[model samples]
Target: MNIFKKNNNLFYLIYFFLYLTLITGFIFDENPAGGGKKDYLLLQVHLIETGFTNGVMHYLFDFFPNGTLQHSPIYYIIIYYLKSIFSPDIIRLIIIHIFLIIPFYFYKSLKLINIGNKYICILIPIIFFISPNFRSVALWSGREILSLLFLIISIFNFIKFQKNKNTKNIYLSFFFLILGSYISPEIGIISIVYFYKLIRLINLRFFFKLFFFNLILSLPFLYYIIFFYSDNEFNNPLLVNLYKNLSSFFSSICIVTIPFIIFKDIKKYFLFILENKKLIIFILFISFFILNSPYNYEFGGGVIYRLLNLYGFEKIIFIFGFLGFLNLIFLIKEKLYYNLFVIIIFILHTSLNLHFFQKYIDLTYLFYFIFLFDSKKINDYFNNSILVKLFLTYNLIYYIANISYRIY
Candidate 1:
């Protein structure tokens, strides 16, 4: 199991080289290569005008087409500061910032968990670089980047809580969770996990304190929506039509990864189950409850706005996806099962990716894989042999193609 016995150094060197290539590609495409040119342009303009003043909130509340509001102004303010220095290339720099944050956050999270091997972090950037769906966000200008940033921050705090159940750390986790919710309401689904952590205290005083803080934090957004949101939900028939099937088969596949992801971890998972059964079951129940809840599926009316509203839970799906893959990898590495069952299920999950989001999903899969792969046993197999070279080449090709697309 000496995964790093041969050429681990070379592997890491090339991995980071590819990561930089993707960063360059994303930075060069600042003019809107895809469908979000206008969004970036508007954000860049707004950043120039507003500085750090929270004017973007007023803008989104007043004129954003969907009447959807963002929760945090911190990222916008940061962008404003960057714009002041970069001037003409502010958009490009901002995107570079987003692209860079993935690796930065990835490194930080792993380091926090004591798994931050240079080689492991290197492999992660390589995997994420190959993910075309990540490129979609890497190229866009919106709150997805902000949501991801805050989500990673929250995860860092969660890991902190995992190690030390300090009240301050727990509150810090919840605070970032709330910030993430404001950044992209879709990511709010992670709040249930946050709530679970809070409720674990089970004391009435702590419960009231958490509840009151959440309420006070939400008040500004609630008031703004009630007083200023002018969009009429009842008037949109097309939205109504979409509401019914919002969580239809496609979303289910995306969120659940079907039978394989579900069974992948079930068959081989021993570490967490053996170590923390109660917490594991709690996660499972909450994950299922959120996915099957009525609000997750399309309702009968105001389909468009409501359809967008349904996205708030996707963050939960993302977290579960990470866990599911990690469980399978751990199972395989531990020799818990020497069968093809895990491979078969993952293939089935891959087969259903007709809409091409699997590549992006692979990012989380790879994240968990490399994080765990850095263990001493797995690192023993890291040979800088031909097989490793070929694997690294495959990842580099993905970066090359994406960079070529941006340049040509």
Candidate 2:
């Protein structure tokens, strides 16, 4: 008895058309477009060819010693078998990474927020495709989407357990949280957020069991890290370049949060800014000190990093001043607490992935938008003049710009 079944058919038809459109694009793409996808493809193909046998994935230690072994063994093993049969196809990657997981995550997140309309739930994924970041990331054939699926599933189950006190959901959450982190530790930092609930639910004995099991699962990876660190960029005395990490983190945060200000009532946005002048100054000062600290990720150069190279720490403070100005909109006007997990996700994501985040911002930014709506508002406003034309118009323009933007 869903009220929006009529609209649901139209969206399904639209999605089917979009699916076909994306398939045509994929068909023409000869050089796999994502960052690190080709590398992962090569690794999987190599693993199978070179005696990656008998459940001993120790080849992870031999082949990807630069901490690439940090990727969960399951993904490579799965891909190895797939490539063995299918000859290293990109379509398999696309079906699992882009078409399957990303859209499902958006749907689940919408449902978690109590968005009930089937049509509205569907809108989240469609709108995601409009984003410039999505086109690039989906094309870039990486394991990030796989990690995102596990991350989202874990979050959902944890929150479900919180509400229902369901042990089954909690166990599933633990499994997924570990699996997701093993794939990409960046998104797995979400485990920290669940600590708030874990503290309330678990006794000391259960904690010991949880710790012991996860430790056993993680032991090989822990050993890999110790051996891997010796020859890596982090082997240098300075683990990360501080000024770079913070500024990059600040820039990425702005990308996800700035749109609310850019698209909304600017007068009120600045009024709140003007009202909170002191807080803004304080934030900039603090951001300045923070930017002086670690550059965490192994950076892949891009337009953002190039421009950042030209600016000084003073310039970074000035820019954060601008983002701080826009943030007034969230702090004063919107119910920012509703997105506490998302806000934390973005913060930790940027913090952890400062080096290579430019190529990967698509992973989490789309979810920020996915969780931005409620079912009622989505239904009411999806066809509104501003949405049907203006917003989508902007997103489509951005999408086109990214076509030639060099994903790989």
Candidate 3:
């Protein structure tokens, strides 16, 4: 008991130390790294407040025609209201407060699912904070982190509904999921995964009733997208977007799965590969086709591409991408349908984007791998002291590297 207490204290200390760094970074740095969309978001909020004085309907009508508004308006609308009540600095601090609570929410969700012990669950949020993107999004205001909070809440409610079969829990899950999607449309794709789970859990009558209820709630955002959403900014060919995004997406999966690799039994992985030779062969063929395709090395292929490019070995991204596919195969073999659907939906969602960045996938995939993927596997690895140390060290190094890259 004393040992657990001591370790728990240490974890709290480390969390506060990291938390302080985020606060300090936000305060001292004129332009915190990442959140390339910050300026545009703020501008949109300003425009909404100053120009759209008539009403929300006026903003919706003028949205696509404005051309300057790149994202969904929900976040901007929230910010606009907040600005009316508080100064800009206070609004930013409010966002940071929202950002800080995410770890606690993560801990709550983990505990709800019973993925790991208290100690392991505590460590999960620390791992979340270690991600460079987490800090970046926290220190700088953006929709991603706020959207993540709502999604985590949605996941929590969904887990509760699964356990208790409570109608209220499922309703709450749908509500938060829709709320998150409005904040960031990319997150909306996750609704498909949630819908799939709902289909199996509820009867047809209840399912249809629940579906229409959420659909009614979602109508405002649907109307916005139908009338105001524009893809004029993304002029690249659809095939080009797919090729680049797939390579980056798979590479991202490989990068975030490193901690799992570090502690997992390697022989088991190889054994699965050997037993599924046909599947292995199929993955190899697809990987090779992707590798052979003409792709621009200049724009995003994710961290693997950037790191390998430094050594003039960027082509190795394909190998990591191949490994990523194998990880998905493992998920399929384990019958983790919810997780598999989340990943598939994320890929499809990102593939349509104008550019792919490591920030888009790193923290998001890490969250899935830790909290949503194979729980027994996570427990086995997370319980190891060495795995915890190595994972933290790796992320700290990543954080430093990102800062240096941005500064230079």
By TM-score, the best candidate is 3
Candidates by lDDT, descending order: 3, 2, 1
My TM-score estimates for the predictions, one after another, are: 0.54, 0.74, 0.85
Quantify all predictions' global Cα lDDT against the true fold: 0.48, 0.54, 0.70
| Better candidate number, 1 or 3, judged by lDDT | 3
lDDT of 2 at 310: 51
Clashes of each: 18, 5, 0
Q: Over 4 Å off in model 2, which ranges? A: 3-6, 30-58, 66-74, 90-98, 116-122, 200-216, 226-243, 286-289, 292-303, 307-346, 366-391, 404-408
Please tell me which model should have the higher lDDT, number 2 or number 3. Answer: 3
lDDT per residue as tens, model 2, 2-65: 5455566766677677666555655665222234445544655555566366444455655445
Cα deviation in Å at residue 304, candidate 2? 3.6
Candidate 1 C-alpha error for residue 34, in Å: 4.0
Clashes of 1: 18
Best by lDDT: 3
- Give per-model CA RMSD: 11.0, 5.2, 3.6
List runs of model 1 lying over 4 Å from the truth. 1-15, 27-33, 36-61, 65-88, 111-119, 139-141, 233-408
lDDT of 1 at 333: 48
Ten contiguous residues with the weakest lDDT in model 1:
351-360
